[model samples]
Target: MHPGRLEGRYVAVVGPADDARDVDLARAEAVGRALAEEGAVLLTGGHHGVMRAAARGATAAGGVSIGLLPGSDRAAGSPEHTHLLPTGLGELRNGLLVRAADAVGAVGCSWGTLSEIALARRTGVPLVLLDPWDLPADAGVVAADAPAAVRAVVGLLAGR
Candidate 1:
């Protein structure tokens, strides 16, 4: 709740890595790039699909991309992530991600993504949407694409 915590705060990116032909990976990439250029860290599930795409985009911009893994094992780490946070809580690692972020970018959503989005809202952080529907209004939802998500988060960081 402190001012400027979001200035360079981490953004939690929640999505499914099971789908190889997902429809929203592009949006995730755009969101990641935007966050990176703004100098914010990107946090993810540490695998493929949306997570890998976002990590790649962020790392390409020279920003840090971190993966929070379940069960304390990182053998499946996405190559783009520079750090891995192994919580050993399996799916419950979602809580750690929600705790670490100043905001949330809910993209390529699935059952797991929905859980993360809901938890983030419960935590009272801002949220940007790429999957668009089924999110809480209390989350300060950003309705635009990835670029807009980044802009919204940056504005929040600036206290605008």
Candidate 2:
């Protein structure tokens, strides 16, 4: 790694969109806000639930949010997203999302989220888990909340 700063880096927040819980949504939003405050770009699935919440937080913080939509219609993504890209890759877009991120923060548990997490780990990307599935210690750094997750990601990205 280059030991670059977190600013201008892309950090993807992966979690359940349709099946997201309230707590996860809140944590995702906070994580988005914190990342934005640190001058990082936020990326999401670009739909509802956790994605929308995180996008909203990024927007509120005057930060850019890029949404990668699985559908062909860009309008299908959340309006909160600053930029929307329609991949038409369906579930396979998860790989693209994970690959584009300099780091990843998974806020909740879902099949889609798991895929993203696995992709990040496989690619050697820094990852953080918040209120997510139970995994081995080496899987990812478990954070108690959003701020901690963002800090951990920054640390990892900074090669600290």
Candidate 3:
């Protein structure tokens, strides 16, 4: 989408961009789709695996999706991203992912995803988990189902 049309409203979606083979990627993608269906923007690492799937879900739902690339070169972007942000900071790129988003959503449990969850929690951003094994004691635990998680998060976003 045109960059001008997408601004102010953004939701940073953080998850494992490297676990496409080991885990069920469809679940993560479904979570992303749920986010998009709710009309919030989607954000991610902007590459393969979870990021790509999430981007696809958002786009399929007609929601804006942005990718915060970890490298300076633009070749790292996934096909589903609506906007590309190239940051040559490698793993440090997680910081940008966490900060740029108004709220954060986590799907899989991997190292990168864990870091993102930590960052989001530390930043005091609203967060939702699709299959969270562990989370803050006071986190509003939504149902494990994708639709329920989406509804819960959207309600949180809407202050419901």
- My TM-score estimates for the predictions, one after another, are 0.87, 0.95, 0.84
- In candidate 3, what are the lDDT values of residues 1-160, reduced to their tens digit? 3432223457776667666543436765776776776667888888888788888888987777889999987777998888888999998999888898877777767788888888888878888776765767655344576666666666666652
| Winner of 1 and 2 under lDDT | 2
Scored against the true structure, residue 156 in model 2 reaches a CA lDDT of 92
lDDT of every predicted structure (CA atoms) = 0.77, 0.90, 0.74
Clashes of 3: 0
Which residue ranges in model 1 land beyond 4 Å of their true spot?
1-7, 20-22, 135-139
TM-score of model 1 vs. true structure:
0.87
Worst 10 residues of 1 by lDDT: 1-10
Question: lDDT by residue for model 1 over 1-160, one digit each (tens)?
Answer: 2433344688877777786345577778777777787778899988788888889888987788999988667877788888877778888988888888888888857778887887877777777776555555665565567777777777765662
Quote the positional error of residue 104 for candidate 1 in Å. Answer: 0.7
For the record, the alpha-carbon RMSD of candidate 1 to the native fold, in angstroms, is 3.8
lDDT of 3 at 158: 68
lDDT of 3: 0.74
Candidate 1 clashing pairs, residues 3+ apart or interchain:
none
Q: Which candidate leads the pack in lDDT?
A: 2
